[model samples]
Target: MFWKSQRKYMIFLIKNKSEGEENLINGKMNVAIIGVGYWGKKIATEYSYLSKKDAQINLYAVCDVFDENLEFCKEKLEIPHQTKSLKEIFENDEIDAVHICTPSETHYEICKEALEHGKHVTVEKPMTLNSLEAIKLVDLAYQKKLVLSVGHIFRFDAAIEKAKSLLEQGWFGDVYWMKFTWTALMPPMVGRDIITDLAPHPFDILNFLTNDWPNKVTCVAKAHRKGQQEETAHITCEFPNNLLAHIEVSWLNPERKREVQIMGSERFTKIDCVTQKITGYENEKFFDMPNVRSNTIGDELSYFVNCVRQQTSNQVSVNKNNGLVGANVVKLLELTKKSMINQRTEPVQ
Candidate 1:
């Protein structure tokens, strides 16, 4: 049943590969969100809400295969334009960018089409189901000179950002290891398991904290649910500088939890992403660190808009959520999957 997921697979040609500043005209960027499902609705709402205040950005359109989703967007979001055909979004000359929030498997083609049409794109996590497709999207974006960012929202969190700053400042001197736990009890997301569904968040955080990708991975997983996918998974990533990262994810837990523990030579830290709290352990004492709350999803979307705006004006160095980080995340995940299948450590390619 999970394999027979909703949403039809989209196929598009790689036409109009010409690259220029298509995202910005008269200092405004018009964006369309494809797929108004759970995550897509959130994105659309953010964009629509922001569009009212930000004159430089416009939430131009919304698209989804499900009519119910479209109707909901129309009623609640009051979005100016809505469609079931992604082709309309692509074919529209006014839209300067597109957000691909469909299933993981559909990311490659939709993003490829958006870039091919000279529109910037932001695809949700696990950019693609596999690395090959991930690489293709990355390369296509680079070739087209369009911003193709992946939605790794936690990277914009204030707590994680502060924790990363502390780590970089050597507060966590000579970091030896880190542990991430993301587990909860909820209805299983169709076409997703703990590994593919939940692992990307922490894995991307691991990369963000260290600014490095894991060189190797090993995993053990079990499928407790009716799907072929694992409902619980334990994955370990070996990074350089003797850094080891462990990720534990499951849908079998009784309560919801999101926690990260990092152990270093000088001090250690425990972060609760949900509560926006951090506790530092050092010198036989634990103290809570003050954290400023910020809307991560809003920040990420704003950053994406800024990147598109800058890149359109030929300002190339502006850093936004790029595709390479997302690709690396996909590569590491594929490696872990291989390790699970082989029951041994697998080198990340």
Candidate 2:
């Protein structure tokens, strides 16, 4: 019921905000984007844009353990303040929020410390290794009255957002099984596997849309990618009301593909995330849903900061909406971990 009610509330809220076509995020927040790596750089760039053009936030500093990463961000963005320690942020009373773009393993420790110090935190996907850890972190943030946000970037996707709109308006009929595939080829195990790393976006977004967790999950994986970890997995999730979702993740494909096909009773919706486009198919009827595309990268960071500085309505709701997304991610990660461990020692034929 939490998901159902929140969807209605979200619909009402966004409709009101869109009427004026004015900026939804209006306040300036003092913020720092930690872990200056891949997505971390995106966070910094968004913050930098807000600082330079939009004035939606003040990019306080960039923090990272690797001196090279710190220097890279500092020189590339012309940012002056750089630190290897998170202590500087807590010591200063001025900073209000911290964006953590670190690895999955570090999310718990970093987010916990930040929240303990009363700073709002936005940790990247795969919120934690498991649900118990996620439950604890979210609970702590709530106890501290701090906003804990997860970087499930696709939740902010224009197409997915529109899908939510359509779903609310009863655009799609009784939902049927949906399929989501995300695949890419990379230099051998340069990093993590596909299921643990790549699958979170789709998994999180599915829960975000349906407002329900998978009652059961099963996964099958392979070790074709030359790593101890299984780089590809075919997984399925069963939710209430006969809603099923199939997720496939692989790092062994040639051309990378990221797409979702949400089948409903009346029609089917195929979304191409990379292209940011949604195509709909119905018997004797085929049409396209135009992009409600906003500057997700800019708007998302601004949204998190604006919520903190304004002290009003925000997107990341603990135990309300965003928490479930994190919980679902943890559940999926557990299955992935099990698959990885079993595959690593499967007696060779």
Candidate 3:
């Protein structure tokens, strides 16, 4: 129902655009979204909604392994094409792009196949289960001259973007260190742990804000439920210029939290990713930072559409959520997992 309402709002925008913003977008681009699970549905809805606003872009198809999901997309969102086979979507020449919202384990093969079929690809983070596969997908996207984006949503968050801009303006002078917390209580998911499931968001956000990658990682984790995956973990990363980042993730916390704090010699900033709010503190004074609040998922999809429309690798969009950046995040996660196993700090290889 919420997505349906969003679609209506988009239709209103489209009606308004016809009068004034009709020339905003240059060319038409067709996109398909594979996997209609929880996250996939959101991506598809945004694409469907935005298609109304940008006449050039269309939500060409939606794919899922389950029959019911396809039915829902067709009936609920009025998507033109709904399929149970990925090959069907891949075979459609009209689809210029695809968003991969499937499981982490399936990301590599799906993204590679999409790129091979001459489609720009956007896979949900972390890009792949490991760095090597991610590198391969990145290389394939480069070889085909297609845009490869990873769904690092926090990069599109208003608060995070604002904080990044402030840091670039040197508002927080001589940055020292930062901390990230993402915790919640939830049922265990097969083949998922705190590091792989929840850590990616904060990891990518830190990389986005710092404009640097971590060189070293130390991780400590525990599986409290005896036979299940690790439910809690702490990871410490060392970045260039002696900057440090600490992340804590858990599925056992009583109170949910998604926050990042960056401390510097001059001042400090606190960001709430969920609220899209940021506050700066200096000299015992706290001030709320102004930011333009926008639906990050919608913004991310729009960026992908623009990239697809641009076509050429030279003119392709580049940001912290690109394949290369996603690959780096995977590399760091791999190192963090290694550290957890060896009980020692590991250099990011």
Candidate 4:
């Protein structure tokens, strides 16, 4: 049955390719933003800018359940199509791809539907709630020959990219440990927890810098305002070569900070994720590393559109924010939860 479905999907892709070639030739790809709420609005804004700057992309439509969100798209974004139905977006052959900014829990279902409808997808982080569902989506995209990208937006950050380059060059020699501090003063989200909501960025950033995943994880989390879900948490990840990473995420902290610190034998480097600033301390000397900031969301959207235009298959592994990377981060989140519950270190299996 899987093989049969895969064959039919391939045929569908072939037909779609032929029919869509004219648009491709004209360097035009119609894209949609699903769920233009808080985060989705930001995504929509970037796409709106991209549409005006690049003729290749069209901010074709937006889908949201709320009337106000749709209204925002209509008035603010000037999107051509605005609807409250996913069915309408999926059935529309003009929309070449979808950027899903819906809540994390809804990702798997919507992403699956988009792929089944022969649309490329770029779903936000925590691609799904679990690794199993993430892997299934990965496989589906592979079978359909579609671009399946995750919103690991930090990977597109100039500072993060520069840090990766420096680490690759062994500028931070004999790395000792790393720390990620992501804290904000925000009220508890009803159904969301700190680990799933905030930890994805740190874990994904760790993978981005080290080009590896943690072998073991130990996590401690608690809820202060509400007992339903954790509001504050600390996760310790054990990577290969004795590299340790500590991630601190909290909704209780008054100050907002998004920083990554790396301690190495050569220098201690700190990256201000928001400001795109990198500072290093070496031999009692503090120096600022020059880095030009980038609009991460815009770059990420452009990369996804390029992938769609190239018909980049998940099998080719051209995308940095590919499905497998998202799945790995989800697996880490699951393991972190396990460690928190068991009060013991859990191995990443």
- TM-score of each candidate structure, all chains considered together: 0.91, 0.84, 0.90, 0.92
Candidate 2 regions with alpha-carbon error over 4 angstroms? 1-28, 54-56, 310-324, 336-349
Q: Give the per-residue lDDT of model 1 (tens digit) for 271-339.
A: 999887999999999999999987888899999987876774444435545787787778777777889
What is candidate 3's lDDT per residue for 185-279, written digit by digit as tens?
88776778888888888888887887666778999999888566899999999976889999999999987889999999999989888887888
Alpha-carbon deviation at 83 in model 4, angstroms: 0.5
**Cα deviation of 211 in candidate 3 (Å)?**
1.4
Give the Å shift of residue 153 in candidate 1: 0.3
Task: Give the clashing residue pairs of candidate 1, or none.
Answer: none
Candidate 1 scores a C-alpha RMSD against the true structure in Å of 6.4
Q: Supply candidate 2's per-residue lDDT for 196.
A: 73
Off by over 4 Å in 4: 1-26, 312-317
Local accuracy of candidate 4 as per-residue lDDT tens digits, 1-349 = 1111234534654464422211221268889999998999999999999999998889999999999999999998899899999999999999888999999989999999998888889999989997889978877777667788999999999999999999999999999999999999997779889999999999989998998888889999998886689999999999778999999999999989999999999889999999999999999999999999999999999898887777643233378888878888888898899999999999886
- Taking the tens digit of each residue's C-alpha lDDT, what string does model 2 give over 263-302? 8888889888877789988886778877867677776776
Residues forming the 10-long window of minimal summed lDDT in candidate 3: 17-26
Per-candidate Cα lDDT values, in order, are 0.82, 0.72, 0.82, 0.87
Q: List the residue pairs that clash in candidate 3.
A: none
Q: In candidate 1, which residue ranges exceed 4 Å CA deviation?
A: 1-25, 312-317
* Model 3: residue 239 alpha-carbon error in angstroms: 2.0
* Residue 314 lDDT (model 3): 39
Give the TM-score (vs. native) of candidate 4.
Answer: 0.92
